[model samples]
Target: MARIAFILLCHKDPKAIIRQAEQLTAVGDYISIHFDARAPKDAYAMIRDALADNSNVTFARKRIRCGWGEWSLVQATLHAVEAAVEAFPRATHFYMVSGDCMAIKSAQYAHAVLDADDVDYIESFDFFESDWIKTGMKEERLIYRHWFNERNQKTLFYRSWWLQRRLGLERSVPADLQVMIGSQWWCLRRRTIEWILDFTRKRRDVMRFFRTTWIPDETFFQTLVRHLVPEPEIRTRTLTFLMFTDYGMPVTFYNDHYDLLLSQDYLFARKISPEAGQLKERLGRLYASDRTDFKISDEGRKLFQFLTGRGRIGRRFAPRFWETETSLGRERELMIIACKKWHVAKRLVGSIKHHTNLTAIDYLFNEEDTPLPDLGGIQTTLEKRTRHRRALMRMLFDYHETDRLIFCIDTANLDLMQDFFSDRSTTRLLEIACEFTDEYLAGHAKRVGLAGEETSDETLKQLLPTIRYDVVFEADRIRDAGFPNHGKIRERNTPEENAARIAEFLSVPEDTARSIAQTPYLFAD
Candidate 1:
């Protein structure tokens, strides 16, 4: 039997972390945990006592006071890796994950996949070539020296960023090292882990340089793996499912995400909370079962249809068609709009109403048979009724100036919209997608409503391409924009928490912010 070593980095939630440990406990397996040094000593003791019975579980002799966006995270991970390898020298594969992550697939299945491939599973992309980081923040993170205190709080020693730029005081990233960044979660072969340990020990300068960089955990391993491993030996896909909210927080998985979780080919899902004990139990039982394969279930397929408006089993529902030619006449600075779904459209419009002064535009694909509710500052227009969604999108493109700001209401038409507007350099596009759990169920209902007896392969091929979206929104940007609902459907931030974020972002009174957030639409005076 091939032995697997799991290195878990845990900060808070001891109960949840211990539960994760229990699930992975098995013969020929080793679990090495590195608890954040900042956590209460009692909490660490509690976890230690809980795992006392498991001979496979061990703790890192060294723990770092881990801080977010700091080099401490990288140090902690390295420590866990070192400890795991030391304890279980015969381990074939090393898997690193957060304490909140749980295995979606059986351990046997995970081992089988690894056994079939000699390659490493890690996601990496060249920093300069990708838009992973925000436009201007890349330089700030890589070049400037950032220091954190014992509390893991960043200190602002230099107020004048412009002064530092003029003086050229910032250090350049190592010229010999090609900077790569990606998700921190990864599973590496034993030989690869050994090589990384050896390389980092010899390269003190590299280690020191990364210590001063922002979020070094994400970059350090990616850069080293890319530099050392042969291209054929590396698999660029991570085996974890992590959805980020506009606010930069990982979306917490709940019972509602069961279908979405099943839909993914990933072996593990992250940031599950203790409150979802039932969900955890269910997943554990499912993972223990031998019959469950790595294929999407029927419910998962229905969800896929609901989300992207594809895979309708029987019905051939056309994109809602409405005929109206209402242009802004003159190009406006910003316009928000949605596709056929009115409920989604209204909510999106409401989220941005108070934050921005731009008016909302509704692009109806279907005829306006029923009257719509009062969406303040939101105007409705008929998208040219056509069999092809691309044709109607082309009409919208023709109507708006290339430089106008357009907020897409949902992600269903994201693919078609991106292709149509790809060449329009000046057009600013911000797409809003609803992430509520019930929304998926609702989508399933809609799919049933539009069901037909047969959907031809040609129809699916045409429909699937148009409905897919290529755009990915960052959680931080979405949170900054005051969008209420994002990330996991079950773990929504409280209204008060959302209001505070809006108040801070827009510099408004808390009460005023709460009022604005209450209505999904801006109230017309």
Candidate 2:
């Protein structure tokens, strides 16, 4: 039921613009274009002639020489809005978009959502009240006059600001208006658009003030709408899916991003590549489809956010094993228990399995008696096993679906200990202390393929704390030997006391810890 009047601000790619106009016209919407005056006249003529047969499309008569961060862009937008208002008489809303934008959702989907309310879809926030400006030109943008193009005339632009600062030539905004800033793309009610147009006609002084303001297109309508409509009637978000680069340019979509585009809940996406024919074709079909419900998968949303650099990049364990990239990002936890004696480490893991909900496994990194028998390919040789120890642990981390896992390794895997400690969200470590004789140390070094490596108690003592760990359980004898604690060392004591310490370290209940300590396997020796 909602009739939308789309005003496209175009500068380049006439063929692509023609195709987009056709798509919008086919969707039962009105189209108006305000081609840049500085762009090639031939390009504008081509677009006009191509869409001449369509009664739904119209071009603005007045075109302004638009420039990035200059007043001309806002002037062109005003001209387009005027043209759209006169052309589409029954338009419920006036939606402004760039020529490079493509429809991500069907027109009916947008109409269904907008027809539910008379609310204005625009992002408007007070400039001084919010950290809206990311380029560090927050207040100065409105306080100074900018005549030079920021994108093409960088030298003159910066020099103008510098000279103005030196001379202390600062301008004041109108006292009646509180300056607002937001995204340029907006879908505003037709009544709201008319009110803005009327205000611009009467308020010549306010128009002049914004004439020299930097990027006034982003601020002019944003500031006016706040004054015309009540705050409750406006939704402070854009319907267009836009992602900007660190340098402040829109990220252009290509052919490979078709699936990504489908996953978006937005109606449209901005700044697509002009030559992306396959992407355009697929999205055009999406617009023509009768699918009503638009829902996005959580996995897809997270991946898209990560792709745009707005979300964290998750760690992948064995990427080759799966068709898509999978990351164990805080989904499951990995706790590695390491000690010199395998028997003692096994006993501790047994106790944990006896009490907690953790999936505990003994000697995961062992050569012959590994808990994971399927790891034969990864642990074929001692050298390869030593080299791929980190990968092995991460594979285990990814393989298990449990909320928490406790696995046992030996001090021989100390070189790769730091890798497990890097992502503290999913990994923790527990080290139990034991005496290593000269023969035992030599055998350990030879077994782990580090025969000639510095393998002594002093070397081991110096290396343990340097590699970060969650907890270290040791008797007072090791403490007297000047082993640097790094606040992770725990004094070995009675089984019940040890359980209490482990319980506190793992943040489990004291009762649970006592139950683990009372296990026959833990206190047998």
Candidate 3:
């Protein structure tokens, strides 16, 4: 009865994302993806393709910098919550995730945690009480003091001891203390959102001050909820669980193995890297009663559909000027950069599928010995799946000559399941999607999207702003933006190595038809 909502944030890494999405999708849940407003259209589109099977995931409209200590990041999150809650009012809890983040447990396990009628799965850090959160607040104050004195950014931190509170990031309720907590990346109830938003509208002053604070998100959310809520329902620990790393990439993971992380009793985490292929199976173990080494059903399929209804996806929301404003980009323009198969991509995809014209899909790695053709199942070969998951993700994200598109996934999906295609939909309508003949989609009667996403909504000009983008990233680089920060670029292989490649990658000539410098969406003069 408790509907699960996964909020997946995308920056780079397509193949890894798809694999993880598929795995997560196997478990039914509401899914939504918040591509960094600045992420390339192609990069965003590739993520869409990965969720083609389901009809709940949709692209978000808010485009703000998701820096570690900026109001812009908090703004993006609040806005994203606004969109998701509007679409899935019935949703019981929302899980904040990153492009690289993955669920070590099955959706069911998580569902149980959230669905447990008695316990409210709210991931909050009562800053007033939390030592870690208090540290962050102290850090904010110290930094602001230094910045104000040296940098003269005094007006920014003028309010109180908690700089984030004064900067408009925190809710100034009861008193003016800024509510601080984990980066708002956690599982929470629908009521919590309603209360927070309402709190914001009422306390405009406190909210306004947070806009200039250092770690707005962490400080703001924690401070507000702790102050407002009675008896503090949040887990005091830092995180509930985690993948190999909070940073999105590809690697191995297991719910049991990561139990220590989960032991924190916290609900959210940041860095994560999991083999795309094993997502469903690995995650399944976390919740489902069924246990096996590798199987898709374990991924959370039944739960996925329960959260994101197919009918919701068919109804199109008015497209923003920006989506149509930019030129249709070149094919394969988004490919050759970023990998996927990380994080449980399904939950995010499911959320988006609900609001878009894009078609949601569940692409299972077809292997022998499974009972059903389109049911949930994980991969028999984890190693090979991981290697190929990335390769195939490139194919999905990269544009081809004919369609000149990365595989276009349609219909906003609540979540995309990767483990195994379900034998059939629980409902009758999902069986017949616009282009798909599958029983589940057909029964749902959801509209499918483009043959594929040829061009992305965002142009090359805007491609940062999701997470601490300025930080040294070991991910891809834009060879040229056709402007000031343009041309002859080299790409960093990993997020950790991103900064080092900046100078070299930016200088590679694009005119040469071919160069180490890869082409982003070619811009119009």
Candidate 4:
């Protein structure tokens, strides 16, 4: 069997780290770990003891006090790689991972893919090519001289370090080296690793140059490997599924992310916190069935095929609705009224009548018993059948010919509806029904209350990254539009306050925005 050496750098989550080490252990494979020196001694001991019995697992003798965005991280990784190579001389490939990362695919699958490929799986891109840097901080990271404090903390020694370049006080990068930036995690062949080690050792100037660089871990190895290897020999994709919030931190995976996780082509996922209920156990169960051969089971193949759109399942479950021509020919703003219950839809229609000047709206219902107003009863076969929420949504987008379609969906259909509109190029908005207090929920019927709670959770997840704005119903805001007081209005931004926000977003008046924000229902009359 071809051997793979894993260099794991960890700071926290000892138990998960041990589990990852144990899971990755194979007959010929070697695991080398380097825990951050700054972490508690007992925590380090716990990790060390857990893997002490495993002969294939080795700990780095020289531990680096790993600091984020510092050279220490790169040094720690170097130490781990050196340890792994020293311990397992026969190792053909090296995989660098963090403690929070867990493999979603089988180890055999990884080995097979790697063995078949000759290219290094490291995502690298030129730093100067695009606006890859975050707002207002690009100059500080690339041009400034950020030094480490006595405690190994990143500190700005001179704020005007860019001026040094003008006066020739700046240290120039090596003429041979090109600045490359990429994801820190990568899988490289042993020869590549050795080349990196040799290059760093020989070029002390290059090492010193990157020492003052911001987040050099992302650039150091990337720059060296890209410079040494041919472009054809480097693959631009990593096998890790990492998501980031607006703040640039990894988004913690939760139970809701199970389908999303499995749908990805990546072999590993990161930042799986303990708060993500049952995810660790679930991943363990997945890895338990992993075989030495990379063959997937029939059921697993079906799922993979479904997610990749290679199967006939989508065609079989295709919606039965057909598109009808709109009378208002080329209207820019098209309001799509999506409701499950007839009563709510009718009330929404009434609200639209009271609020907006529009005489017609497109209404889509899933249930058969739900009545439609008599503009023309062009009932689709799906409207009479059992609820196929997603299918109906797909049909609505496919058939509706409009420039800008504003979907007015109840809380129950928000998630799936968002999924339908995810890939569309046209502009759209999702208005959610939010109840401010328990009193509002109590006032509504049982089903309505349940729907509100479900919508609230889905909206908070912000699953649809495409849609920029979503309207949330405020009790006080609706009260201005003649809605009864269901709960006490809090001091939060009311619908009136949100008028400027909506107007700026949609390019409409703050007063007309009240019609869209206040009218929870927009049923066809």
Candidate 5:
């Protein structure tokens, strides 16, 4: 079981605590909080009431001022860890998040991010150095703290001198690493946390220094893990959906880089003031979500909204979350292409008609008498053949006003090209299609790795870095559809068909099929 150990630093801001708890409850995640001892009892009661339904949350006994350089954060984190260990010491992993952050759907997405295949999601901006070793921190954020405490004579100046002079503790890392500043907000494997706890047992001066300093929270976990562990894997930057800055501090988003921090791809802007309602409204329109009434001031709320629910952004490309109705254009201007299925085809067309954009999706597939599966509510369409695909591509390029056209393909059969072109050739179709259109696609904006693997043909080199998937499955769907689901898709699903299409598409000899198989890019590549 993967248990999330959420720790809320309950400042006097009771409303923030309540809202945070509510958001967590919405996703069935539990939390534990370290409320400031100075807070009113009423506030705890309120927090308790808001979080009551979540069996996973609890209020910790240790109350301390939440600050940087102080030992409180470390202590608080330890306490939360102890509680988590007690609650579920056997958990697969532990994720530590603040109260302000919330979830967006896609548990699968979370799983994938945390999996071992991907490195931890951290952004390191700056770099420091003591030669062979590297840690993240640059000229920026290197001196944002000042401790005037008399007790700090032992900690602040003296400790700084000790580390600087005695330990020779300086290091440099990639500059981009300085930008992301992986926050304490992070997920750690159970073994990693246990390792961290064990590793810190021997570092006495570090703990002593941390006690009287400010922003110790910022450096403690990072420095300790980095120096001791060969590859400490600490994040200097935070990666949560929400971020905070005091009023006087000026925040720069990596220097004017991009026009927007789009939630669609890796980021969404949060913490705007209520005055930025126009932006909120615009975000809603741009993404097509029903989320309205923007809060320019509530960064956490905006973050929560973005992380947990469908905002206009999701609605823009995939609006199924918002409304179920689709539009049918005035002229019933749909060109349906089907092989021979009718039952499934009728049902499919009916389903497509139920909720499409008006003046969108002009073509349809329907000549076949095949039994089309009634796909309840999932959206769908007919497959395109090599010949028809050329025709469609030509039509789109020639008219440039063909409303919207969708090419649908059958599932399962849409695995690889060989399945579709089992007995048919697609070379002519490929050429014609290319002639009619640029390598770029233009029909509609569809919301939409690495390394190694050599190919045989000395001319056929490694692929360049690109996000574009080779459309292997998509192309297979086109090939297997045997023409449209209505008209004649002359391509037979056989070895001969595969040979012909491979020859046609690749402009190779018929005997090249066997050689293509060894190329790795062809199948299982």
Candidate 6:
């Protein structure tokens, strides 16, 4: 019977904010909102009037003019938490989120996740030991006083820092306390929140030190919580889904990214576009629905890995050389099946399936099942689709458990061929040459009245040499019967001996390799 009290820090979008409050209140949870003092008075009034009838909603007593990388953001959050705690004393836990944040899953799912553990969910890592902050200032954020707003007053902010550096001016933190850093978002138990609030009220000197520290919101509670709560009671991970761009701005989710968002295991996601009305509505319905089967799909994980993990700029080389350099996670291993015809792919897939534990996905580049009509135009749609497919291929390589994978691709989907071969570290490829000679291919293209085939053929021919692979199956030699699926696959090898060529390359079990070699496989177009 764990009850959660939500504290939302909102500035604008009164309508969206009202809807968010309504959705949370409808499910028996209490929410407190802190509207920024700088926002229009009418926006704040509208949000208040909309939630006037709901007893579960309340507004903070004071609204602070919050700024990015400033102390006021944490002050606003504190006001919201104070209001929520005072209003709802029985609340077991407190969840802090921004106005644009939405519930990706049901409320019960969150309760279920939290009820199993009495630990606090907040990202707290040693500021000195951990490389939590990705780019820009690091230890300098704490050492030098950051008086100007980093976002609005970029020039003054830098100038102040330079002046401080030139003068050799450095601030001293409390010797007893170790600084910590993490994402500002968190879900903490009431006891933890109460302890943090109490600690802040009593420790004026420590608070004064943090007020001048850069991005205090990310460090304040993170450092204080570690001081108040025991290590065993704390779980250093944020329950919120937060992804940042290379420039360190949080990624804004749009309507077209619905599928990608659904693929994550996070309970809530933030920084949604204000214009994403459709996405907001759909997620609302999903939150209210009694659906229990929430799963993280392979496609979703792959998309996440691509966007946040492997696809990030400069990540590929940094972590390999620098011990302090960090990455999202490991990329998966991949193997590709490039075939001339569908039947040849089918034969190879079946042989591999019979021999190994690997699962072969047939025609992965087929048209996407869901239509993204809102994304606009044919070109835009194609671009999004291509991006998603690339993410999928990358995700597959990161699936570390199953090392071997077979995917079927024909000349029709040559658009994705280059993308699949982009990452060389985790990819093992096999190619199946066309059965027909160049002259025969040209004649066939003419007879079929399909000129596009000639273009695709040339594209494949030119692309194949540039791509790296472990083996290639000659169409001429494989035309005869009794072709072994496993054997020694060298640059110079005859097809006279029935062999398990791919199995040999993959080094599968001997018994499985024998089964693959002995199996009579027929290839059709």
Give lDDT tens digits, candidate 2, residues 30-125: 988999988899999999899999988888889888787788888888888899899889888989888888888888887888998779988888
Q: Which regions in candidate 1 have their CA more than 4 angstroms from the true location?
A: 149-163, 297-525
RMSD of 6: 16.1
Cα shift from native, residue 512, model 3 (Å): 90
lDDT, model 3, position 191: 80
Q: What's the CA RMSD for each of the models? A: 17.0, 18.1, 26.5, 15.3, 21.1, 16.1
As for model 2, its CA RMSD to the true structure in angstroms is 18.1
> lDDT per residue, candidate 5, 126-209, as tens digits?
224422112322332333223433244556645564455466553333232221222455555566667767755765544555
Q: Judging by TM-score, tell me the better candidate of 3 and 6.
A: 6
Q: Taking the tens digit of each residue's C-alpha lDDT, what string does model 1 give over 111-209?
A: 788888899998898987887775336767778777743233423534444466778888878878999989988999999999999999999989889
Residue lDDT tens for model 4, 211-288: 888778878888999988889899987878776655677767776655445445666788677776477677655655
Model 4: lDDT equals: 0.59
| Residue 282 miss distance in model 4 (angstroms) | 2.5
Colliding pairs, model 2: none
Q: Compared with the true structure, what per-residue lDDT tens digits does model 3 show for residues 1-525?
A: 667667776666777666555555555566666667666878767777767666666556676645445576678777777777877777787767776565544454556556554333434554455564422245444234222321244454454445554664533333546455554555667787788889889988777666655666666666666666664466543333432222333233333324322323333334443543343344434543332222111112221232233224331223334332332333322101111211112322233234323333332232223222221222345333333342333333332222211121211211121100111211111111111123322222221221112212221112112111311121222111112212222222332232223223222223322321122311101
lDDT of 6 at 423: 41
- What value does the lDDT take at residue 280 in candidate 2? 87
Clashes of 5: 87
Quick one: ranking by lDDT, best first? 2, 6, 1, 4, 3, 5
Cα-based TM-score, every candidate: 0.60, 0.63, 0.44, 0.57, 0.39, 0.63
Candidate 6, residues 233-276, lDDT tens digits: the string is 99998888877665767778888666556556677888789889
